[model samples]
Target: MEIATPMATDDRARFETLLSRHRGIVLKIAASYAWHAEDRADLTQDIATQLWRAFPGYDPSRPFPTWMYRIALNVAIGHVRRHAPHSRLTVPFDEALHDTADDLTNDRDGLDRMRLLQRFISDQQPLDRALLLLYLEERSSREMSEVLGIGESNVTTKINRLKQRLRDYAAAAGHD
Candidate 1:
């Protein structure tokens, strides 16, 4: 076993603080990729471990959330790819639907819409799913480009295409 130095202890404290502050990002990505609760937990752990390993190299000048998102998304994409044949993609939205609406009919409508949106997201390839998640989070095009390692123009184009696809899906589902 290795003894911790002062520098190492400081780094550990910093890492824990950062991770705690942005824990939701990890959980969101894991939920989007992992259909089962156990799988989500495992993916969250995997992401945290990878983040810790990469912490020493993290640039203090840049935004921490963006860096965290990049690592978390990569891990989630990898998890989905590795389990592709055995699992389906899912995201948790039940609470969102149940908590927002006051009327039963409105709740039903929200649930239907949520399910449609979820299906569209689940049907996407992992990279596209990541793009959609970033887009939904209101991340700027440049930031999305940085996280996805794509050009800003490409990010805009993909967002347009995704919007069109969602429209088409809604139309086909009689929600247009």
Candidate 2:
């Protein structure tokens, strides 16, 4: 067995702290990719596991969210791809929209809008869904490129195309 160094212990502590601070990022990615509660939980756990395994390789100079998003998106996309053949992409919009009692009580219209948006996103391809998630999170094109391993110009082009697609979908659905 290998001995644990003091540095390893410190690193572990730091990783836990960062993970706790940014847990919502993992949850949002999981929720965006997973349609069922059980699947969301599994994706969340998988993301955490992957993050822990990858923590040692994280470069401190880069933004934490950037690195975290890359890992989370990769895991989420992989999970979706693996289960796509057997799974339906139907998200329980009402249940997912009202995540808390406060949300349930307030912002009914906003929740409805979010539910519709979620449905639109769920109908998209895996990469398009990922792009939408990153865009909704307000990540910069450069950041999206870094997380997605694509060129910044490609990220910009995709975002424009995605916006047009969403607009077209809304128009066709009579929500325009």
**TM-scores of all predicted structures:** 0.90, 0.90
What lDDT score is found at residue 13 in candidate 1? 99
- Candidate 1 Cα outliers beyond 4 Å, as residue runs: 90-107
Q: How well is each residue in 1-176 modelled by candidate 1, as lDDT tens digits?
A: 99999999999999999999999899788878887778888999999999999999999999999999999999999888788888575565454435644543456777688778877887888888999999989999999999999999999999999999999999999988
Number of residue pairs clashing in candidate 1, backbone atoms closer than 3 angstroms, sequence gap of 3 or more or interchain: 0
Compose the digit string of candidate 2's lDDT tens values, residues 19-89.
Answer: 99999999888888888888899999999999999998999999999999999999988998898899764
| Candidate 2 Cα lDDT to native | 0.85
Worst 10 residues of 1 by lDDT: 96-105
Best by TM-score: 1
